[model samples]
Target: MSMYCNQCEQTAKGIACTTHGVCGKDPEVSALQDLLVHAVMGLSLYAVEGRKKGITDPEVDRFTVKAIFTTLTNVDFDPARFQNYINEAVAMRDKLKERVGVSFDHNSANFQPASDVAGLTEQGKQVSLDSDKETDADIQSMQQILLYGVKGVAAYADHAAILNQTDEKVYAFIQEAMAALTRNDLEANDWLGLILKCGEMNFRAMELLDAGNTGTYGHPTPTAVPLGHKKGKAIVVSGHDLKDLEELLKQTEGKGIYVYTHGEMLPTHGYPELKKYSHFYGHYGTAWQNQQKEFANFPGAILMTTNCIQKPQESYADNIFTTGLVGWPGVHHVDGHDYGPVIEKALAMPGFPSDEDNGTVNVGFARNAVIGVAPKVIEAVKGGAIKHFFLVGGCDGAKPGRNYYADLVEQAPKDTVILTLACGKFRFFDKDLGDIGGIPRLLDVGQCNDAYSAIQIALALANAFDCDVNELPLTLILSWYEQKAVAILLTLLHLGIKNIFIGPSLPAFITPNVLNVLVENYNLRPISTPEKDLEMILG
Candidate 1:
């Protein structure tokens, strides 16, 4: 049971198969997950060693992103298909080793099985457990945290690369961290330091993505995307990559296929270059978690530019197109900026009639754009038009308790404003929460990693209000499902931001003592009923 199920956030008490994982991952699915991570560690080691000998290649970054992305929640749930990714990683490792003239003895006694005796000593498997050593659960937990953090970093790096923002140092750190996870000699402190380092590197990764996005698409500014539909045949592009969406808008220009933003793509509507597209329609869905239901009856083809892809049902499968690192078993992948396949598929789908109404959504409140509104926002606060700022954001999942977010947003005082990032906002994004003054109640702030932007906005507000961030009329209510949240949380800690409310449950991987440390130092609390949590924040 242990052999196949060794991913981060896996069941420590036993294998995770409680209806489904807390993150929606199943058991058989988890084992193939372990294999993929193991294979990536091998590939990263080979790539790092190869670079020492004057070898520089882009494929290393590509392989690193693919390997790490496969381990993300809800990205790949099929064990058999995951093993294929592992095989591909092994093949990449072998090819890199051959080019670098290096050989690794897999049978060496140094290799330590990640699981215990009962777990590793399966009936017919050749991998053996180390007889003299027992892996410490704390150390393992720390290592997993670092690895998952790096995975999040890799995802951001991939996005930046798509926008022509490549950082060699970032890719090198990815290789370094992946290779470190496989070494059994490292101590707990060493792993802890690496975990912190992962946070620091993620900061760099997010900066790169910010530059890539703003530099290419122009800074996102305040723009009201029309939620009402207009007449046209259109295509809706979702997910995080503005570059791909820009290219698609360009390709489909004047072709009668209007483009609309969905989910994280809603932020693209704020960019000067992207918003200039007259055919660019408004947002379609709330968040990635709602894709299956939201896309069920959409009138146009959908293009997923990055993660947060739900397993598509047969009804809309043919209409779903993917680009960049996102892929599904049967979906058509539009590689590079080619987008030929996506264009062709959109044309082939039963698009909306010429007279059909294309809806509109309001977006664009990124750092620069929001900072531009600082004077007015501060004036409103002084004028008592807006009372508080609520950063109700993070990753979204299928857990039953997750609906608390939607309910919490619904119940927030009318005087409060919501600043959201990542995929979590899908819950109440479509709700007519009304506005405080002229500002809409809910503001979409791009991808999950864009939590950085929310941080900047909070700090700016505090500076304007002449107080520390905590002293300002601001609160952070976060929902996490994956490592990007881990990295972002660490950054908040590094900055001494405290009193965060986190839920639907504490991470299963965080030991009680670690939870205590976080709670005592940061005043972190698990989310409870929306009525109660809202009262705590609003009162």
Candidate 2:
């Protein structure tokens, strides 16, 4: 196989993408990502030892997580960027090795990456996924599960750190997990335990991220976000970073430019700090999967703050820019938060010629908002006004069967409340699900990273009703596309929540044996049609 990646739901033919990634990642870029991951694995070796000696480097910790996040699906497709990360990883690894005064005969610990991208690609082919065929398939699956879960945790940890909220435990677990991937002694059961531990670490990382976002911007209040555009020069900020959006908003204030959110940034409008900007106007487009078409029609500049960026079309190639860990070849990369170039681009372009009132969608029903009205919610449930609650949200994708989410949401009984999050809500966000007892039937719980909020809301309800979360009349019908969703699933399993129905397709990395383990242990099932699944769930 020239390249092997099955980290997402839309892998080629529902199996491994053996040639090129379906996410527009070429073979060379894929190879470089593989090598970068191996290099990080090497750095993690020394990092684990350095911690044992009570010596830690903040640069190493930060770089380790950021580098892993760079390799996540749809984050960076630039081979040169991956090459730089690989070089930096090796340099930090050797620097730590010198400080610890330690040496090892293991190939991973002593490996050296080539100076050139061509040579590094060769090195990558050697250390690619499943390089060690001697390992059991189930064990390999568990190891990959742990690795991807760590990637999700790294993404959250990086976001949290950006907001000046961080915990060393998250970094330590990332390094330990990467270093553990080099070991040959762990059994399948042992790997399973580590996977659960990864889940626990993910929970902490997400908690830190929750605190960072809410603390930095204040808890999101119920806000109405416009779906239409206003007349002015405009910039649409995509991805999941609120700080980036805040910085752009600050720079563009009084510049006669209107800032609109796209994709996951839609939730940022609910933040008090970000929404305080008068020029922060409305939301444009749907999820990342539809960006190419939606962006082509947009008349202003585009700033991608994080992942979920696609190959830009020729029509708007000059209008799109990427920042942070998100990168595309030949696309202008903005460093830090200096958005001067973006502002200039937006001003240079012709924004909407006339205003369009496309109505609005309500966001900001996070844990705080939901729990703020716990009495009302609990009373509604007790009074038999609200029936079962369905938590139906996750990463949206371009693959078939994703329409199942919109179908499920539409067909959901009026008495049932749907608590949604992530970009997947775009399928039915505009639907007037109506309210019960002054409570909106649909509650947006924020981004995929905000799963902690959903968990807290569930726990609060469970506490109010005096029952386990699973015992409550709530069901999780989730759709996943990437590692973040994988991490959230692991967190749910770690919390001992049962009967999670995930679709449209399961992870390709999971072996049948490992799948059986999750199914048996957690009662996890692949989602059937919306009709069948809803019947089974609501019955």
Candidate 3:
């Protein structure tokens, strides 16, 4: 009765998170998130109406992206924050109505939520993924997919917004689609079409972020990042935010501290502007899911810039920090992009006393990097030196089923090239897949949002080959865990690429009937053994 959440791939027991979220979200926090989503959907009803009157507010658009983003798993877990967001969402909705100078009797426009915990829970009880009492199970499944996909869009767009990239169309799509969720008229086919359209919007969202990141820090370059630490005071930064990491590195300059990238932040070092920092030592650990143990054993402070932050262990909880939209109940949150608190914590903590040769992993094969060598890659493909390209990327998790990604890379044919993005590449990124004519068989295409890079690379290759991207020798085995991954998957579908094999499993929200539509139309397959899926893909 406390909560009901299953928005992420690694939901508790592969179903709903009732009592506590697997991502460390408490029941009250989860309930608040539910209430907040309910409130936002109501706001979207009016926002959609006001937009038709040509009354649009960028702040409401920006807030829409952020408020839903905060509810995503591992992103935020503060009930108070959700309450404030809910109140603001309503205020913005009502204000937009007044701005348009129109009045309607829709219950959603007049919706009001209780300010207290008990009242919020009661309000949330009236909301569900499929509000239509008569929706078909299959149609409802597509509805969930669409809803989750929008949440995914919000997560990425939120990051892009922080970097000062916001699109009015993306905002309009978010509000329009969230309001669509409350509708009772859409059938199975209608919902499926909405899914594809959402994918198209997500593609634009990803492109905006790609531009945001590259514009802010320059396009990522291929660079070798040291996996070991330097002997000095250090601050380890995780998550996918480059702006925060750059700020921390800027503040820590000449302060006798080394800034080590962790999790998805590892790719930040490949940016020309960021890599130029002398005190930017190297990477600190593997993926986000391993942070608990890796962080516990680390010698310095840790700053989590985004999601996948677990409950900090008491051993190093005092040194753990959060920034941007990420939150933990008691952890210090960096305000105004100031990293002084984190720097002081790093200064007080004992960092690595001696450097170790922990090897290195290469990254930053983004679009500019990959396309820069297009002629070389194209010649290699034409000369038959490279027969296949596999894009295996997405969020990494603690699930035992996630081993398939590592296994697929190991089992890939020697004549093939593996192009990966996101935290999932940590599985076999350092395995030394060697080279095919000076081109490393394994190419790291930046972070999860940078899947935009992979998509661009695919399109360029397809253009060179004079064929559709799917007509080229390419297969995408996406390993999804959270909403960002959902957004990316939808982007791929939107591009009309088919025959994607996703695993460790499909989203629990996909009902059997809805899954059938995906299988029949898109040939989406649940990943089996790597041996089997690879054989199917390669042969």
Scored by lDDT, the top model is 2
List TM-score per model, in order.
0.84, 0.99, 0.97
Instruction: lDDT for model 3, please.
Output: 0.85
Give the clashing pairs for model 3.
Answer: none
Candidate 3 lDDT for residue 264: 88
Model 2 Cα lDDT, one tens digit per residue, 1-539? 38888888899999888888889888788888888888888889899999899999999999998999998899999888888898889889899999998986666677888878889888888886567788888888999899888889889999999988889988998999998888889888788888998889889999999999999899999999999999989999999998899889899999999999999988888889889999998999999999999999999999998789999999999999999999999999999888999889999999999999999999999999999999999999999999899999999999999899999999999999999999999899889999999999999999998999999999999999999999999999999999999999999999999999999999989999999999999999998888998889888
Model 1 segments more than 4 A misplaced: 1-15, 18-30, 46-58, 76-88, 91-133, 353-360, 382-386, 432-440, 465-468
- Give the poorly placed runs of model 3, Cα more than 4 Å off: 101-107, 130-134
**Per-candidate local distance difference test:** 0.72, 0.91, 0.85
In candidate 3, position 100 carries an lDDT of 71
Best model per TM-score: 2
| Candidate 2, residue 91: lDDT | 88
lDDT of 1 by residue, 25-140 (tens): 65445555655666677777777788899786687677787678767665655444565665577777777878888766543212333333234223113321211146676666
Better of 1 and 3 by TM-score: 3
State residue 330's C-alpha deviation in candidate 3, in Å: 1.1
